[model samples]
Target: MQLKSLRMLEAVCDTGSFGAAAQLLHTVQSNVTAHVKKLEEETGAQLLERASPVHPTPAGRLLLEHARHMLRTHDLALAQLQGLDPQGASQVAGTLRIGSMETTAALRLPVLLAQLRRQHPGIDLELEAQPTAALLEALMAGRIDCAFVNGAAPHSGLQSWPVFREELVLVSGQPLTRFPTPQEFCASVFLAFRQGCSYRQRVELLMASQGVTAVRIMELGMLDTILGCVAAGMGYALLSRALVEAQQQRFGVHWISLPPGLAEEFAWVDTCFVTGSVAGWSPALRAFAQLLGIHAQAIAAGEHVRPGPAQRVHRRQAEPMPA
Candidate 1:
């Protein structure tokens, strides 16, 4: 079958319908149907289940895995060849898909992205905000080119660079005079992002450290929502000090430092930029990584890294307490 046919098959599976795939591929439904039929005829096996929302049959799923590899190889080859042209060296152009944790996306990426746009106008950037676990999965599945995740790469196939450091704090509506006892902590609800969030995992660990075996956790999707709930005294949340302080005034929330041992063990975290093997990186990805490297270096040197406009706070109504 032709590469175009494989592409059509992949699109159909991705969009779950012939018409939707046509829309995504910028083609007519008839063309998509013809291409899919051609692939099935060539392979002598049914590829898709003709349902309302179509699904790939077992045979189709196997072919789709190979199709993605072929497509990625073709795209990477084109990008590399373009990069070799001396005339185009200054203007690296490609779509760079990035995945990041919501907190990082909110607090860290704005300045970096602004710099990237000014330096490389040809690069098209797409950013997706998810939890660290989701971002890692997206990176491995090829849905995203790189990710700003919680820690170093956990899988052997991936590589990572430490890009940012975060100090975690316990947030609440009321000021904390001292560390809460296990009984007190158990009586409170913990608000966090959905199950896959790294911060959510830290909340559990923090509770366990307090000798609390069972605790209640409320899963919320947005950072603002979690903060708002905390401000309303609905629950407590564990978040980065930078992130919480950025919106403390608006949310009327307070935060306290964790005990030194707990902070060292669970509260201090490195947000890493992770990607597949170096061989798979596109020029756009390389450029972004270089910028992050420079930022990391500046941070290491104890220079003041300015926050982007979105992160800047004009005034703070509350300050973090030492617990």
Candidate 2:
């Protein structure tokens, strides 16, 4: 069938909603529904199972996989053709769909995006923020061009570039004088993002290492919500020090440095830029990677990213004591 129909099918499957697929495609809901229905009629099989959030049927899934392959091939062909341009200055213009973790979106991407826009005025950027695993899935499925996420770069059919290392801090509503003992730590509820969040996973490991048997976990969906809950003394959260410091005034939470042992073990997470080689390299993607390299170089040169005034004020509120 037509490539447009296949593209619509893949979008609907990825979004799990026809309406969302339409939004993604910059079309209307009825058009997305009609495209899928036409495909079903032509194939003589039902493709999607109707539900609140629809799911692809077995037949639909098979088509979706093929659709991904075809679309990736098409994108690669376009990228290669563009790369062949003798005039290199015009090669960097295209749509770049990027996925990211909420933490990175909140703390790091605004400046980078602004710079990108200024440098490549012809490029169009679309961003979606999700947990690391979800972003990886989107990248693999050709839903997004690339993703910025935490932890070691995933090895399967993907390439990764180390963007930066994030220093994590444990934050609480009440002031914590010393690092909490395992029992004390596990006593309070742990507020965190849903499953697959690297920060949540790391905190769990930290507690387990300290001989903690169990912990209470509250899964909050958004970063700001977690911060609000932690600041209200509802629970504690683990977040990038940069994020916590940036919003310190709004949340009024205290950041606790871990004991040297724990700090040494769980203090940082590497943020990596990941993309699938199967989809080939778009000029937009290459440009973004190049921009990341410039920043990574500065970090490698031992340049300290100075803390903002709010973070400086918070640090001065108490003498620096080892957790």
Candidate 3:
């Protein structure tokens, strides 16, 4: 059938009623009905169940699935063809949906997105903050165009590359001359994000490695809230050192690096950019990937990278620790 027919079919499936679909597609109900009817006649299969909120038949569901892929391909082609800059880079002019962890968004994306916005004024950037696991779920479901996730290994149907290596630190409200033992640390309440948070998961694993089990956890949704609780001596939290350091002045939290062995293994978390295979190579995504690649490469080459607002505060160069 025609592309317009597939668009009508998709709108119907999404909106769940002929009238709603017609309104959404900016056409009359008769046109929507006609398109679906034409598709059914051409395919010789019943397409939809005539329900209140219309349900797709098995055949309709199959076509609708392919319709989504085809539409994505069609839109991507148009964007790529029309949105190129004179400098040979993709002029990102459409919406770019990005999912990220709050920490990564806070520490890493600000500068990157600022530069992008300046370079491509036409791009409309959309951001959603979630735990890495949640971000991955959204990416897989096509809800987000790409995600900035915490350390992960390769997986099927997705591609990921390192953006930065971030140091995870144990944070507390008060400055400590001596760090607690693993058992002692586990006894303290853990302030963290919800269950799916990668930093929280790493904390659990690190504690478990020391035979610390049945630890108490407090689910604090916002980073500022969690840090506030920590400043009140509520509990300890595992977070990017950069994040804690950035707010150390406000929160008066102290950070401690992990011991050598565990630090070598779990202390450093890789922030990665992930996308599904289909959208991974989109020009908008490619531009972002190139930026990250250049940054990572510069760091790897041991160049003296100037610190930005979102930069990792190097532990070796001490800032005055908050009392």
Candidate 4:
């Protein structure tokens, strides 16, 4: 009946444990149990089976199916009301071009865009989704204003700020205990990305260092193709944890953290064409910064699994502008 009860039910079914659900919901186990019991009583049916991993009863299963839609609807209603409220300023509008990697476009950007749409009704946002290398190239060419790319992309004419570091996870159909060491990686058929990918080079180096010569490899330019290959039990590849985890449900794959841990560093790159406007800053930029703030907060809250880098390496700085 209540959204709180629906949320508790959803969490219980998903987590398969009262304690886990309560933890995720930031309450005690008893509170979650009480909500579940309340819902069961109201519905006049058992909502869950108290087993090792919680299994939802039939009525609960139906609610679980509808939970996502319900939650989305609730958020939408809240956002619309907030947007129209006198306390909320609603004049922000205009087209905002954002360039981002396919990976980030999948993981990070969607939530930002949704919030942006509800909060700033005037902004029309467009995306240029490409691989990291191409996106950087376009960014330098003034094709896109800003982007989040996988790996470290060096551009001579822009200022790069560390957005965050993303771990490159090795996901396969099953656990990779058989390929325990880095040496085994070289022997296995290594899946690779297009030339100029920083991750591909790291994978090669990891393989070649431990007597791994002449690795069998497959190069796929698109993320979907790469994921498809991995899901179908092809060769292994290195990819951003954010992107892989986003698609984990749709694709059946087990993850193994790479040894020494390969990681991709992201930067928010802005071009050298600074004018009087850039010096002053704009509201869209402010909104974008706000979005980045949300991102940083989410990361700090430990919503994502961040693995350490293979080794500490300084970011490449752009050339100094002529005075």
Candidate 5:
């Protein structure tokens, strides 16, 4: 079977959608379907299930596991070979792939890229801005070399590096004179992304533990939509402060504290989870991270912008408070 087909298979399994896999691979959906069908025929068993999107069969899963390993090994060997030619890239050549969520792409990487190009002029850096779910899939499928993502360090097969502690903020378009008590907030309209949103999960879980029932939640397809709805006085949302601030001017939203004690830990994922392989990771990622200014990088990478008690900058129409 073609390794390219296997790559397609891995992506389909990770994303659970032929169309999504094709989109991530920057190819047509029909081609992804055709490639998988061909691979299944070669394997003499069903490699993928035919359904909305798609799923991997038992045989398909096994092949995907192996394919992930093969691609990772290929990358490492390439890196080693490239390293052998260090003479040429004591100058840092070749494609550098970075994956991240939309807010991070919109907020953080501009500074990082500006400086990255200046420092690693020989490298061709490709920026892939995706949602957290898709980023995780591409990471595991070996589609991206490394990525900075938000959410809990997933309890999957990947290794996570804790980079920052992001407090969850309750965002509202209307003035929140005080942090809404859990019950009051739960009664208010809740705006969020679709089913798999991490912030949505966090808020729901918190409410569940506190015995709040029948939440008034409305789902919007995109972050911008959710924020726009909130800014137009539709509902409140929970998210990292950086994201809220990133579009604060355009969307006209502001953040208020969660009830009291609540936050989420996030990190930059270097390895793919299900693939269980770190493709060609080196000291370079960390080194490049260091080259970036910390708060600047954190904000750019869509991590919560941490402002100390003395250094806080408040954009909301209120006195500056600690971020």
Candidate 6:
């Protein structure tokens, strides 16, 4: 089958409708239909079910997996060969799909992305904010080129670079003179991002450490909403100290520092830059990694360091936080 046909099939699977896939591929519906029909005939299987929000059949799912692999390999090879030219190396240009946690997207990415825009104007960057689990899933599915996620990479197919270390704090509506007892914690409600968030997991672990088991957690999507509810005495939340402190003035929320031991255990987390593998990195991705490496080196040398909510570094070495 032709690569164009496979691309049309992938688009249909992604968009879930022939017309929508045509729009996504910037082609007509008839072309998308013809390409899909060609694939079905070549494979001798009904690839898609005829229904609203169409779905791939069993055979289509199988071929889609291999199609994705082939497409990724082809793209990487083209990018690498283009970069071999001196002019192309300086003018690296491609769509770089990056996934990041909402917190990182808010606090960390602005300055870095600004620098990237200045250095490589040709690069088209698409940034998606999601929880760590979803970001990792997208990375493995070839939906994103790289991701900034909490903690180190978990899968053997991925490689991670420790980019930032954040100190988490316990936030509440009122000031706490001391740590709450297990009973006190159990009696309170907690607000956090949805289930896949790493910070939400930390909230559970922190409560369990206080010998509190069954805790009530309200899942919210936005950072502002969580802080707003916390300020209104809705519940407590575990968030980066820098993030909380930055918004404390507006939200009027109070954050308590965790005990040194607990801080070491659950408060410190590394925001890592994870990618599929070094071998598969595109020129644009390599350029982005180089920028991150420079920033990490600057942090290591304690030079040109901007100390504020945006660039909070708990440790100078940029090591991965304990799991």
Q: Which candidate number maximizes TM-score?
A: 1
- lDDT by residue for model 3 over 1-323, one digit each (tens)? 78899999999989889999999989999999999999999999998998988989999999999988898778766766566653446576667899999988887789888888887777688999999889999988889988988754246788666567678888998886666787777668889999789988988888887777777789998999999999999999999887888889988899888877677666876677777774445666666666667766665467342332223433233222111
Instruction: Please give, for residues 1-323, the per-residue lDDT of candidate 5 as tens digits.
Output: 78788888888988989888999999999998899889878888998887866777788888888999997777655654454233333444566678865555665568777787787665678878666677777878878766666533364655444333345677899878887666776668788766655556666876665567667789886778888899998878877666677678898888876543333222112111121234544434433545543544354367444533322221121221112
Please give the range of 10 consecutive residues that has the lowest summed lDDT in model 6.
314-323
**Candidate 5 least-lDDT 10 residues:** 266-275
After best superposition, candidate 2 residue 209: deviation in angstroms? 1.0
lDDT leader? 6
* Candidates' C-alpha lDDT: 0.83, 0.80, 0.79, 0.64, 0.64, 0.84
Clash count, one per candidate: 0, 0, 0, 2, 1, 0
lDDT of 2 by residue, 220-305 (tens): 98999999999999988889987898999998999987676666668756777787772476777777777767766676467464
Q: What are the models' TM-scores?
A: 0.68, 0.66, 0.66, 0.57, 0.55, 0.67
- lDDT, candidate 6, at 91: 68
Write the number of the candidate with greater TM-score, choosing between 1 and 5: 1
Residues 209-316, model 4: lDDT tens digits: 556767676787777887888888886877666667778888876676654422233211211121122332345555665666566557647745442332133233
* Native-to-model Cα distance after best TM-score fit, residue 228 in candidate 3, in Å: 1.2
The positional error of residue 312 in candidate 4, measured at the CA in angstroms, is: 7.6
For model 6, the local distance difference test gives: 0.84
Expressed as tens digits, the lDDT of each residue in 1-323 for candidate 6 is 99899999999999999999999999999999999999999999999987988999999999999999998877666755465333335467778899999988887788888898898887889999999999999999999999999977789898887777677888999998887777888888899889889999988898888887898899889999999999999988999887887788999999888886677677777788999867777778888888887775565466332333333543343444212
lDDT of 1 by residue, 176-265 (tens): 988677888988899999988999998888888788778899998999999999999998899989888888889999999887667667
lDDT over C-alpha atoms for residue 84 of model 5: 26
After superposing candidate 4 on the true structure, give the runs of residues whose Cα lies further than 4 Å from its correct spot. 1-90, 150-153, 178-187, 260-282, 304-323
Question: Model 6: clashing residue pairs?
Answer: none
Clashing pairs in 3: none
Error at 224, model 2, angstroms:
0.5
